[model samples]
Target: MFSTRKMWLIFLLYLFPYANTAQDIIFGQNKFTEYQIGNMSLIITVPHGGSKQPSTIPSRDCGCWDMSSSKCFFTHNCPPGTIKDSINCKVSTVKDLYTLETALNLGKEIQKITGGYHPHIIINHLSRSKLDVNREKDEATFGVPEAEQAWDEFMQFINTAKSYSPKGLLIDVHGHAHPENWIELGYLISKQNLDSGAFTAADSSILFLSKESYNIPFETLLRGDRSLGNNIQEQNKKYLCVPSPTHPGPSGGNYFKGGYIVKTHGSKDNGQVDAVQIELPRWIRDSSERPIFCAALAKAISNFYNFHFK
Candidate 1:
């Protein structure tokens, strides 16, 4: 005698033969992307840390060409006085160093904190030079069929994870090489907005959080003692995070202000699940401090969950 929920799950599985249940991680075609479905209401995506660069999928062009040059250079290193051609794509081929490893370790740490509750993890295994999943379809894959299919698969996995965690957090992880050795938490608000304090809840990725029953002030949620940045900073005062209680904002410095993944999936557009783009510093992702940072991040995320979601 199956419970109603179990019966419904079984019926749906029967109807959709290719549907995935709560089990081991699954890979997309050609192993371009992989996903781990989790019981916990959290999702993490690593878009720029992929390493696979097969010939089947052509590299995404930078779209900067020298039309006036005799050689007609397609690269950015065009000679002096060469007339620059169209520059269409937001081209960056360099991979976010060690972000995939950081994300994997972060998931493990989170599971340990939650007493074995898994967090949905999605990783794009393809190299950013081959496919930039962070960009839009045309620019990301450059109209390559294989890359297109992989992109669809990656997006579908996120959608599937969203179904499991209907009202949770989606974290887009990446590593940055900014001069300042501090973490950057992007909420879809620009540096100018943060400096001027002119941003509204509607401009935030976690828009739904401001409207929750707790009645938390928007500014407090962004950089107060209970915010995610503050939690991470509390773990170790040395581990500075911009937009925290101490930092407040970037203070007219460089900041990511979130990206396409957060913009497309965050609560601002639809659904209750808020999205956050976390740009980790190079030291946190590349040095001996990786595990330490991962632990702190896991604890901070858990604290955030307990404070807000619980």
Candidate 2:
């Protein structure tokens, strides 16, 4: 006799109490594939840190994989490394150069900073050459059953985190090898769009948190003095970032400007959760230098969340 909406509410409240209480969930068949699902408002995803190649799943066949080929779907050029693998490849798609290490490093430090409190950390541990979790389902999974299951689990993990907290931040961490060593933050607005002065809240990735949840102006939180960029700057002034509220977009060459994953999972939807895609450079990902960088970045995120997201 209950209405559909009421019934759904009851389902979420009592029938799915485990969904609300479970703090972590791990899904994978092997080391090459895995997803770490956490129960925090802050969601972090590293789509390309995997290195387990079974050769069971066929590597993706995309023109971008060919460096000499003229077919490139992504705005930013493919990064260096992962080229030695003989998978009939030219451009790199095997991995994102220490991205998984960076995510795990950041996650560990954040957990320490939060005093055992955990964040929703979702990682794709399969080699991109085997399965590109960041690409569209068709291109990402290539119709493979196993890879398709991974794709589903990744999105489901994000949705699960969103369900935990009505308002939170989701950051997709990636590695970039541009000539400049600056971090590229993607909020979905393109270089041309930002220059035209026509960019609006609807175009942003974190506009939901900026406008609706926090009741703060989108521009101010994006690049303002109280933004995530500022938090990172506080951690290390030597580090430089772009596309913040102040920078808007990259100055030259092709930039990431965000990707399929960020758009699909970010606050572009009507959800209260906001998201940002941070593209890290090798300088920060270096073994010796990574520890310090991760520590600082983790602290910055903690401070930012306490100030704005919490």
Candidate 3:
């Protein structure tokens, strides 16, 4: 019997003879999503930087739709200009500004670093008000047929990319406007758990990495000398990442542990693929800083992958 990894490879070889072929595939209305095929064993997904907003599909609201009342009520406010006929509840409509550009450039930097090995990039171009591909289906599309179609196309593309690499990393790129200017490298460990030291390998998005008997402690892999945070910091001191040696934990500040992307795509027990949610601050993602930071990030990613997966 073939090993699971081998079996997966065989399956992919059968299903996609051109899985390694590099090309751009666009989906959804007005081509709101795209998948850039590449040769590297890496995939980058940008779910929140979508810009298209087709009025044919209503914006997703708080998701607490009231059938009888014909209204949706939730703690958050709906997108701007939403009327009563619309689900007028709060949903995060703010785009992750510049994340798409950052992802695309990061792919190029990775290609340069790897001598033309491109990282597969999946980009969602729909506005967050229309669809939040990171969230579950119901919350993402609010039953809008058009939005739902886009979500399916976006997610299927990620799965397809994963199929090409039995072992790889999925970097879910995002941006944050938090008070702190440091980067947030989320492995699905919450701030509370990180602060209290109450989390374990089971709680990690990169559980596959934790399961490896690398003779290295899990804590070290998380925030010690061997962590991605440390690697990125080593590449550039200006870009500090949380859960690194310098910032071991949130310390009771604003932070995002991770979101649906990492939690869903990250490997489980003994799984080959691992994922990390990278939330960058405006400083790092801004046009002036992006190219330099992408270089640093590509180096860090190459180093981390070599150290762990190679």
Best by TM-score: 1
Model 2 lDDT tens row, 133-242:
77777667657777787777677656766776778888898988888788877888786775565687789887776675456666667666677887887787877767
Q: How many backbone clashes does candidate 1 have?
A: 0
Ordering by TM-score? 1, 3, 2
By TM-score, the better pick of 1 and 2 is: 1
Root-mean-square deviation of every model: 5.1, 7.3, 5.4
Query: Candidate 3 on 1-310: residue-level lDDT in tens?
Result: 9855445445544643334323443344457777777666788999998788888977665645455666654322444433433334456778999999999899899888888888888888999989899887777887777888888878877887887767888999999998988899998888999989998878888878877736888899999998999999999888888999999998998788888888888885445778899999998888999999999999999899878876
Ranking by lDDT, best first?
1, 3, 2
- Model 1: per-residue Cα lDDT over 30-115, one tens digit each: 77888876777789999999999898776766554444433333333445655444453247789999999999999999999999
Preferred candidate (lDDT higher): 1 or 3: 1
Clashing pairs in 2: 50-125, 223-245
Better of 2 and 3 by lDDT: 3
Q: Quantify all predictions' global Cα lDDT against the true fold.
A: 0.82, 0.71, 0.81
What would the TM-scores of all predictions be? 0.87, 0.79, 0.85
